[model samples]
Target: MKYQPIDSQLFIKNRKNFASKMKSNSLAVFNSNDIYPISADSTMPFQQHRDIFYLSGVDQEESVLVIFPDCPKANHREILFLKETNDHIAVWEGEKLTKEAALKTSGIKTVYWLKDMEKIMFELMTQCDTVYINTNEHYRANVETETREDRFTKWLKERYPAHQVAKSNPILQRLRSVKDPIEIDLMQKACNITEKGIRRLLNFIKPGIWEYEIEAELMHEFLRNRSKGFAYTPIVASGNNANVLHYIQNNQQCQAGELILLDVGAEYANYSSDLTRTIPVSGKYSERQKAVYNAVNRVKNEATKMLVPGTLWADYHVEVGKLMTSELLGLGLLDKADVQNENPDWPAYKKYFMHGTSHHIGLDTHDYGILTEPMQANMVFTVEPGIYIPDEGFGIRLEDDVVIQENGEPFNLMGSIPIEADEIEDIMNS
Candidate 1:
């Protein structure tokens, strides 16, 4: 692991919070993600399932975590099932977590090898009346692959058909939405690393530089800062490429007078930080570009203030749209006729800013939080507002990660990362 070991107290508290939500006599299960295959003898990098990692801090393959607070045996209350690591595995694939090490990493005393899962779980199942199954019920989740957790769910239900089944997603959706202080610290670390990457690009970007070259610079900075790399596919769009959301084909060369839109973030210790900043390829924004850039930055700042506790997700966006609408009107992108005649479902501002203004961001770039529920303190979200103008051959977006505070406005994690047009211009020329 490139990152330092997190204090297990975070996982211990997380497990306690989760277990408290389970129905009495219910056993909850979480499985590690599979090392997906690419081709014969080749595999994608092993990524631990976020739920398991959140609960146990076991960042490895073929691991399982079970929580049964009211278990007959006290030692079985919280258990970890890991792959048995031996001398051969140590010499070949490097050493896996030892039993003693797992105890320190997870704060769970009982650890078993994968081979004993069936025998032990079957015995424990008899003592419990319900099973809490982990599922992907995230609003944006569109999974096609059968995950290891999914496979285990199918097998668990078949083997224990008599037991009542409960969904862990709902419980987790609420618990994980509210950030623990430790989790917030980790996210702050991610944002700090992201700041380093963006600062590097501000100096490195120049006319005639390929878009991929900028991506390389960001990756280099992230890796050296103990980040694995991007939280999502990075978008290093230069000039008109910025008009296309999710544009990742970073092969085009930046021109002297064009702007490059970077929608990228770094992941540190599995926590994510999302950031977007559009800057000039030639180190100076045109008069028109500066206006659009300032407008987007203003919208981003105002939208962040609305992230305070008790704000409804849907209502907050509607308010953000109003702010964007006002900006667009000032820029003449929308006229009185456009505003009055626009469809209520798709507002006039949608013409320029189509996607969402913000999303819950943490473990995943789009983290879990129920949209229907009112926002709460400690919830982290991204404040991103953009204006994409293909006709003008440039697009502007400004984004930052923020945490909703108990009082007043949300705190910007990327506050120190220069976003003002003048500041960016000064840094670029320096």
Candidate 2:
């Protein structure tokens, strides 16, 4: 990992909290993600399963974490199973964590090699009456590929058919939604890295520059700052491409008067920061562009204030839709009559500003949060509002990661990054 070692206390507390919520005589298991293959002899980069990392801080493949607070044997209560490390393996690949290193990485003292997993698990299964299985239940999830966690769940269920099965996703959704002080600091680090990437582009972006070139600049900054790179597939859409909400084909040339909607962010450790900023290709927004940009910024600012404790995620979007509708009406994109006659399912603002204004942001770009529940303090979210005008030949989006506060307004994690229309223009021109 490029990032520095995190204090093990965070993982320790996470495990304790999760264990407290588990049913008595139940054992919860979390598995590391698979190193997916791209083709023969090549593979996509390994990404540790966020659940395992959240509880154990084990950021490697072929690892397992088990939490059993009610175990008769104290040492077996919390355990880690890791791939055995050897000198030959270390010479071919990088050093895998030794038992001692695993203990330091995670706070769990009992570490076993993968070879002994079956034997240990068999003993554990006999002792525990219930098994908590981890599953992907995120609101935005549309997973088709069976994950390593899914395989483990299948195997465990087949092996221990009599054991009462319980889901760990619900508990995790609630627990991971609220941030720990340590986690908040880690996410802030990610946002800081993203800030560096954006500041670098302020001077680098110009007419005739390819969208991919801008993506490269951000990647360079993120790597130098100890970030693994983008938290999600980056969108460096220039001009009309911005109208496509998920645009990632960064091959277009940025024209002199067009706006580039940069939906990009950097990841530090395993935490994610999501940011979207629209900048002028020629280093200055035209009068019309400036008006649309400021309107989006105004919507983002107003939407962020609604992220305080007790706000429901669905209700918050409805309120944000109202703010966007007002902005669109002022921009002449929507008329008062359009809103009155608009379908309730598809608001009038949908014509210009479609996507949701905010989403939970941390570990995963679209992090885990139950939308039906009320917002809580320490929950991190992205306040992004965009205006896409295909007729006008440009799109504008402004986003920032914020922490829901106990008091008045949520704290902006990307507060240091320039967002104002004048500030962006000044930095680019200077």
Candidate 3:
């Protein structure tokens, strides 16, 4: 891994919290993600399943974490089954985590090789009445391909048909939503790296530069700062291309007097930081562009304040919609008749700003948080609001990641990065 090692204490606390939530006499299992194949003898990089990474700090493939808090034997309470490292594997790949190293990395004392999983699991399953299986329950998830966890779940249920099945997604969705202090620190590091990348673009972006070139500059800054790369597919939409919400082609050449929307972020140690800044390709926004940019920034700031504890996710969006509507009226995009005759399902503001103002941000960019539940402290969210005007041939979006506090306004992680119209202009010219 390119990033620094995190203390295992965070993982220890995470496991304890998760175990406490499991049903009595239930054992929860987590599996690592598979190295996906691209073609003949070709494969994509292995990304550890975010759930397993959250519970145990294990960042390797063919690893399993079993938490049986009510196990008869104390040593069997927590066990990790890892791919056995041999001389051949060491020479071919690299050093896999040894028992001692796993202990240091995950705080799990009992470590077994992957081959012993059946025997060990059989012994443990005989004593437990219920088994917790992991599954994807994210609000935006629409997975078609079966994952490693899904395969293991099918096998587990067939092998132990008598055992009561429970879902680990419920517990993880709540726990991971409210981050620990250590997790917040890691996210801050990711955001700081994103700041460096965005600041670098201030000097590099100019007329006639290809959008992909800006992407390369950000990637270079991220790699040097110890980040693996972008948290998501970067959107370097320039000119009217920004009107497309999910535009990620990054193939257009930026022209002078046009606004380029950069929806980019840096991922440090698998923790994600989402940021979006629409800047002028000429290094200075024209009057109309500046007006729209400031309006979006204002909406982002107001939306962030609504992320405090006890706030409902759906209600928060409604409040943000109102703010955006007022801004749109002030910008002359909507009128009294538009507001009065607007559809309740899709308001007049949807014409310019259609997407939600914020989303949970942590391990995944659009991370796991139950929207129906009330907001809580330490939950990180990205406040992004945009105004797209196809007729004007430009679009503007501004975003910042914030952490909801216990008793005050949410803390802005990207506060150091320039967002003000004048400040961005000054930095670009400097």
Candidate 4:
């Protein structure tokens, strides 16, 4: 792993929180993600399942975390089953976590090899009345591939059909939504890396530079700063490419007087930071571009203020819709007819800003948080709003990650990054 070792107490606390939510005598299990295959003898990089990573702080493949908080044997309360590392594996791959190392990394005392799982699980299952199975329940989830957790769930059910089964997703959805102090610090580190990348692009971007070149600059900055790379697939859309929300083909040559809409961020310690900034390709925004940019900035600023404690996610977006609507009206994009005849389901603002104004950000770019619940303090969100006007040959989006507060407005994590139109222009030219 490129990142530093996190404090094991974060995982310890996370496990305790999750175990408290489980039914009495229930055992919850989480599996590491499989190292996916590409072609003959090739495999994609292994990304530890976020849930397992959250609970155990173990970032390796073929690992399992079993939390039987009410186990008869005290040592079986929190167990880690890691893939056995041998001389062959050490020579071929690298050093996998040994028992001592796992203890240091995870703060769990009992660690066994994967070969011992069946025997140990049988004993634990005999003592427990229920089993918790992990599943993907994110609102945006559309999984096609059967995961390792899925395979284990099938096996567990076949072996212990008499035991009551429960879902770990609901518990995880709530626990992971609220950020621990250590987790917030890791996220802040990610945001700081993203800020460095944005600042680098500010000075590097100029006329005739290709969009891909700008992306290269940001990548260089991220890698030098201890980040594994982008939190999500970067969107380095220049000029009209910004109109296409998910545009990632950053192959176009940026022309002078055009704006480059950069939706890019860096990941540190597996926490994500999401940032979007639209800057002038020529190092200066034109009159109309500045107007649109400031309007989007205004919308983002206002939307962030709504992310305080007890605010409903759905209602917050609706209020943000009104803010965007008024901005569009001021920008002359929507008229009285467009407003009056707008479908209530998809408002008039959808024409310019189609996506949700904000989403939970953490381990995943779109992190796990139940939208049905009211917002809570320490929950990180990205307040991004945009004006996509293909007719005008440019689109503008501004985004910043913020943490909801108990008292007042949410605290902007990306507050140090330049967002003001004048500030961006000055940095670019200087």
lDDT of each: 0.94, 0.93, 0.94, 0.92
TM-score of each: 0.99, 0.99, 0.99, 0.99
What TM-score does model 1 achieve against the real structure? Answer: 0.99
Better of 3 and 4 by lDDT: 3
Per-residue lDDT tens digits for candidate 2, residues 1-430, read 9999999999999999999999999999999999999998999999999999999999999999999999999999999999999999999999999999999999889999988999999999999999999988887789999999999999998999999999999999999989999999999999999999999999999999999999999999999999989999999999999998998889999999989999999999999999999999999999999999999999898888889999998898999999999999898889989999999999989988888888888888889989999999999999999999998888888999999999989999999999998999999999
Cα lDDT tens digits, model 3, 1-430, are 8999999999999999999999999999999999999999999988889999998999999999999999999999999999999889999999999999999999999999999999999999999999999999897999998999999999998888999999999999999999999999999999999999999999999999999999999999999999999999999999999999999999989999999999999999899999999998888989888888889888888888888999998998989999999999999999989999999999999999989888999999999999999999999999999999999999998999999999989999999998999998999999
How many collisions per candidate? 0, 0, 0, 0
Query: Where does candidate 1 stray beyond 4 Å?
Result: none
What is the overall TM-score of model 2 with all chains considered together? 0.99
Report the lDDT tens digits of candidate 1 across residue range 1-430.
8999999999999999999888999899999999999999999988789999999999999999999999999999999999999999999999999999999999999999999999999999999999999999999989999999989999998988999999999998998989999999999999999999999998899989999999999999999999999989999999999999989999999999999999999999999999999989999999999999999989998888889889998999999999999999999999999999999999999999999988998898999889999999999999999998999998888999999999998889889999999999999999
True-structure lDDT of candidate 4: 0.92
Superposed Cα RMSD, model 1: 0.7
Q: What pairs collide in candidate 1?
A: none
Question: Local error of candidate 3 at 102, Å?
Answer: 0.5
Model 1 has a clash total of 0
Each prediction's RMSD over C-alphas, in Å, is 0.7, 0.8, 0.7, 0.9
Q: What global local distance difference test value does model 2 have?
A: 0.93
